[model samples]
Target: MTQSPAIPLPPPAERRRLREAQSLTQAQVAERVGVGRDTVRAWEAGRTTPRGRKAQTYASLLAAASATAHEVTLRQADPTAPLTPLTPAQAFDALYAFCAPALVRQAYLLTGRRELARESVERAFQLAWHRWPEVAVDPDPAGWVRATVYECALSPWHRFRARHRHPEAPPADPADRALLAVLLRLPPPYRRTLLLYDGVGLGLPETAAETEASTPATANRLLHAREAVAARLPDLADPALLSRRLAEVAAHERLRAARPPVVRAGSERRARNWTHAAIAFTVALIGATTFTLHTAPTQYNPPVAPGATVQGVPPRAAPGALSRAELDLRTKLQRAATNGPERLTPDAR
Candidate 1:
């Protein structure tokens, strides 16, 4: 692979000016450039200049951001511009510009390819743009976007394509590459935990949520990942130092995510209409099924033919009556018995 051309370093004052113009804080710049806030401050104060690849990234970010005003930070850049109230599009533009580099870096760490990382970040930002109203009101929009990027980077869509893509090349530094190879061989969840916690600098809870793991599970994964790496590199066995080393190596290369194209109001309206239509169709289908079950006609047993034998039950018996002659005889016999008692009394008289 060809080496990337070295970027010319801008003047310290110019760097500070471009950064302030874009309304970026030293901490924000530091995070994007993968350095400490004090380092950025020192750069601005002329106490130091970023060296090596760090200088290249710092210079490139300033050079790119100088060309356009970020919609979200316009008010910060110019207090009197009356642009404090920003539209969703404007707000998204600002957020994308500010967070894209770091998000891409994190994604690259996950996927091990610059282009793939850029693609994931761009997709995440586009999703954020579509749901900008919700994203803008969120307490941590950057976290929300970062989480989306994590999902995108780990998507099943990349599963097959990844097999065809060139694998991550080992660095010229044998020791470093050996460690990286070991890390790369770890399970996906373990590697993701290490990257988010140590590489991307997210907290435990944040990393857990991004990886969709519980806090305890995330902690376990991190522990396991650390142990695995330490097992391979015993000399750097201290967890803290190991974490820092991995972080530095993971963030070595970063590609800035481009601002995604905005959706027009009409297109959004159409999309919403389609969503509502789908919901209505589903509800109607369920209602139809319920009605069919509840109102379905039941079948009755067939009537028996005139001489046909009945099944399962016996037939009723015929009714009977006593004869008149028999009734008369029964009355006479009763009368005779009563009379006989009187006759016997006469004989005695």
Candidate 2:
């Protein structure tokens, strides 16, 4: 057998320059660039350089890291003290404060009515705040919150049950309202997938992880969501509305991204405990219903007891004469009949 020729590598100086420009340790650079530590070492030692897509990825990482490092340095040099880390409650409050405007914008885009959006965002944030710890730890906390807000915005439950639910038709903002209308019409899975991908800017893998779906499933959901949205666009009065709405949505995202970190308070802790109690109560109710359904005895009326006529008079058997097997068979037959004819075999006749 013949051995293949060895591949030539990049010079050591080039690799060192890239690393220095990014202001990253070899390991840090490797992680950000999605390369192994050994690959970094090889590049630095003039042993090898990544080729094709890998090389492009490395270049992108170098550029991004350089930009991020500059930003961090600038922030640190400011005279203001760094923001304190928030307690869970404080975090929830901060989240609420941030979500209020954000949700309104999202809702407005979705429903074309500021009032409806405002109500939806408020309710969503309140519920989210109660479960902040779980939501905050999510990979994309903002996206998770936004998804919840969307659900609240279009919830049929509230529309049906709440007397105070928005009764008047939502005022339409041509651009956003169109998108919202399209999104609302989509199936839940498709809607969620679209929001995660386009609205939240998550890639397929990230969306799959967040939704607990396979990559293909997430991709299909996104595709279907877009199709659904596109099919309804003609119904929108203004064709130019989508572009205007997108710009507004982008602005909103930037504003939220720029907010300062917040700290938590004692009262927030108590509220969280109350939220937990509510969740426990709901679970308990569901469990009780399930138990009742499982354990309750089924009632079946047996066919009228057969009577023997002796000299044109009806006669009854002695009282309490049914055998266990007879009682069981009778119940089985009743059940079989109630279920369907398919349950009865030819031999059952």
Candidate 3:
């Protein structure tokens, strides 16, 4: 007589928890764990268990999933919660919130002064906000803000002041001077792109969007900026060294704003109110239109094809066949119908 074969056990509850945390489907988890889809499902469903090396794989995958989940949860809790995974509108808001401080730091690094840098950055943020509808639609909101800030700093008015005025204050600190030397070595566009992309860790598409340029153009700007900076400050070319320097600067300056409060409860209430208002308004408008159409005289003109005779009159011209004068008149009438008398031009009257 032969003994029964040992049965494989299902993955433990911790494994299922890990997979759930990572947002991975059973198939995805199965693929990562090098198990069949059904096996993953079984493990997750507690139908069967993983054994030996398979169990080890499950444990490793679970650990990775847990780590990923933790990061996502932290990101969502960030006061700048709406920005982490950006929609176009959220990108606009993030740009507005962060642009000033980032630009101020960049300007300070370049000009070796805080006051002028802050002014430049503030003005840039104001201008960017004014153009947010257009600029926010761009792929790189941050890059746009950075470019705008640099432009403001280098505008004719600023240049005039720089050229004519004598330094009223003491010379910049030695470190600031060194940083300025490195920054000045970069051309305007390249410097802005590099600082916004590398320094700020914005992606290529984002940088392009912000700069209002093609991705290739942004890439070129970044490349040239890096090269220019590297040539001047060779020490920054080393990844570890650059990271260390940036860490030091970040620690000293603390440029990015603290996370703002998440507007959860109010947002939900406002959304509900708007939805109800919209539904009620729609119902009222429909009811009013129905009453009007019901009460009004109904003309029983038969539908006529263009160029066809109807009753005693020639058929009305097709939309495209109307003369320019007729089209203009129709457009004016349409504007009047939709927008009421206030929108009508004097000429329309």
Output the number of the lDDT-best candidate: 1
Q: Please give, for residues 223-323, the per-residue lDDT of candidate 2 as tens digits.
A: 77666666766543332233344334433322232122221232356577888999999999999999999998799768898985669655565788798
- Among residues 3 or more apart in sequence or in different chains, the pairs in candidate 3 whose N, CA or C atoms overlap within 3 Å are 9-48, 9-49, 9-50, 10-48, 10-49, 139-209, 140-206, 140-209, 140-210, 144-210
lDDT of 3: 0.57
**TM-scores of the models, in the order given:** 0.53, 0.42, 0.38
Ranking by lDDT: 1, 3, 2
- Per-residue lDDT tens digits for candidate 1, residues 132-241, read 77988876676677788878887767767855366756555676577778876888789888876665555688678778889999999998988888788886678556
Overlapping backbone residue pairs in candidate 2 total 1
lDDT of 3 by residue, 251-337 (tens): 355344322122223334556787999999999999999999899977878788678445887666776677889889999999878
User: Considering every candidate listed, which one attains the maximal TM-score?
Assistant: 1
Which of candidates 1 and 3 is the stronger one according to TM-score? 1
Model 2 CA lDDT for position 96: 53
Question: Where in model 1 is the C-alpha error above 4 Å?
Answer: 1-84, 162-176, 254-256, 260-349
| lDDT, model 1, position 22 | 80
